[model samples]
Target: MSNDTFTSWENLVKKQLKTDDINAVLRKENLEGIDVKPFYTDVQQPLVNLPKIEESTHLVAKYHESLEEDVFAFLLNENVENLEQKTIFVNNVDLAGHISPKEEVQYFSLIDVFDEKNATVNDQLVKELLAKQFKRNICIDIALHQNSGASISQQLGIALAKAKELTEIYGTEILEKLIFKLAVGGNYFFEMAKIRAFKILFNQLSKEFNLNLTPYIFAETSLRNKSVSDSENNLIRSTLELAAAMIGGADAVYSNNYQIGNSTDNSEEISFKQQIVLAYESIINVFEDASNGSYYVEDITKQIAEKSWTYFVETEENGGYLELLKQGNIQKDIFDHAIEEQKWVEEGKIKLIGVNLYPKLEVKKSVEELYNNTEIKPVRWAEMFE
Candidate 1:
């Protein structure tokens, strides 16, 4: 439709609708506390300019000159011999500590295992794998549960610090060649902003370390907001959440399908296909960085970057990300945020669809059952580490 035609239609709708009453609908708040406005005009826009399409050189500079030797150099130069030639073992910690040869797994995730005792082991395993493996990616969740109110700054700092340490231990050149995956949460705009900001931050860090590699982002739907009572609705929520991830330029995304509150079969084909359909059927990737030019998105991206930068500087002042984490400062912040969130739910300030506001009927799947049934295991070193 032409701009004038769209504007006329909007005007007609505005005239027919009671402008005053429109506030009631627009002012409605979502679970995330994002306020909706009855109307938006260019006049109410923030004075922020759209984020500049960062120079392509900024990205090109992150990779080694050798990796850019050909059109498919990145893929061809990735050491696949290391991945296929390695033998991995799986040690079942939950069971009688039985060890089995590691079979190739389709997906992997890295989470809370950053103690001094384990850090060395983790680093060794990562180094070994990178030397041998070709097509594998490392999933790292340094930001998970670190703080409240979307601490992207802290997350980025922690991630970069870890990456730095890894590079020092296992040649910066190889570390640059590896992909680092991250976990993303439910704060739609904030999460999207975090990923975009991270790309810039990672590029900056790579330059400082003289490591050339573009950071790869893999986003998963957050587990924190999944509801057990009305679990099906979680699918709809994830659809929107994943859309934000795609718009933010995530290379890969996984939408959680199991009932957050109850345990179901892990092999849910339908849930996996949701992402497939989105990528292939919907063809969302056709328009690269679709949100790049949006006024609101650009504004939010800058806000996220500024907020994250402040947090990162604070982390440095506190002797860096790992130092604060070891002191439990990170945990304290997350606990505080959780407490505030719980209070908001109790006070009816945040209306979770099936939990806080419109509760479900006598549901078969309860939240407790979901947590109890799913045995979440950390990514095993033997599985991916050579």
Candidate 2:
């Protein structure tokens, strides 16, 4: 709606409440410290001119070592037609040998490194992969930051900084082969906006280098909020995350096998079906820009982009992403945020369905266990109470 209608509605609400300060009554703060208003008006000008997503998001399946038959059987049972359209996460190059070279499917590697030695090794490997003309081979994975409990702005900032560091070493040619692997957490709208915001910021950053680049984003469900004791709730959480990724315009997405806490049989099938339901049944793949022109989404996307760009600039001033990793600052920031969030869960401020409320009978672990390691660690928020 227009600003005039919004202003009229605001006046009526204020008169009913008998308070001039309408913002204080309706605004809420999120984890990123951004104020979310109860209602937002249509913006005259959008923050970013979002590009059209040319294809439906690819559903990525993780390939387990020595389970090639099982993976193929699941895919075949699902009647997955075009193998070339799907992506597979393979740790070793040889693991991808089952598919013909003509299939032209993409491969994602876990190659997550935080230190110099591993970074160098990964860099060399990426260069080798690119030399072989592997499509979308180099991964700029920042999913760990989210899974480890970073704010949205922090994750995007670090991602951009990492991309900058890589582009400098590999040259602008690497941009064509770059694929970002991000973790989508339970904060539905913010997680959605995070993807949109990254595209805006990354495009702007690319322009600064006299190049026009649009990023290829691959989103996966996070393990942070999943509860082992209440594993059923994980399916609900992952569904929301997957929906957010589809709406947020991720080029590809993956849902973790939530059956880890239950029966291992048919776990891959279950996760694969979850994605299938969303893509076919719900038809979320039909839209090119599902969140385009949404008042709340547009506003939050701008806020996230602005804050993330500030963080990126600050990181550059402090000698970039690797320097902070060397100084342990990156890990410290994420850990602090994680501790605060976990405390909220424990204090019953943040209600995780089966975690803090209606919890299963279980022994509690010491909170100190989380503090023992200061490095970037992956943790489930419900683990402390489970």
Leading candidate by TM-score:
2
Model 1 — TM-score against the truth?
Answer: 0.63
Tens-digit lDDT string for candidate 2 (1-386)? 67798789989999998999988887775568886878775665776556534487766655444444433311121222344544555444443323343446554444442353223335556655665434556677788878888889999999899888878777876676677889999988988899999999888889988888788887889998988766778888899999999899888778887854665747766776678789889888556568988888998898999999999999999988887777777777888888777777777776788777885335377556865335787778888876
lDDT on C-alpha atoms for all candidate structures: 0.48, 0.74
When summed lDDT is taken over every stretch of 10 residues in candidate 1, the lowest stretch is: 54-63
Q: Write the per-residue lDDT of candidate 1 for residues 20-85, one digit (tens) a residue.
A: 354654465533333334444433334322222221101111112332332121111122232322
Identify the candidate with maximal lDDT.
Answer: 2
Model 2 regions more than 4 Å off: 1-22, 52-54, 63-89, 93-100, 103-110, 113-121, 261-263, 360-363
Task: Locate the minimum summed-lDDT window of 10 residues in model 2.
Answer: 72-81
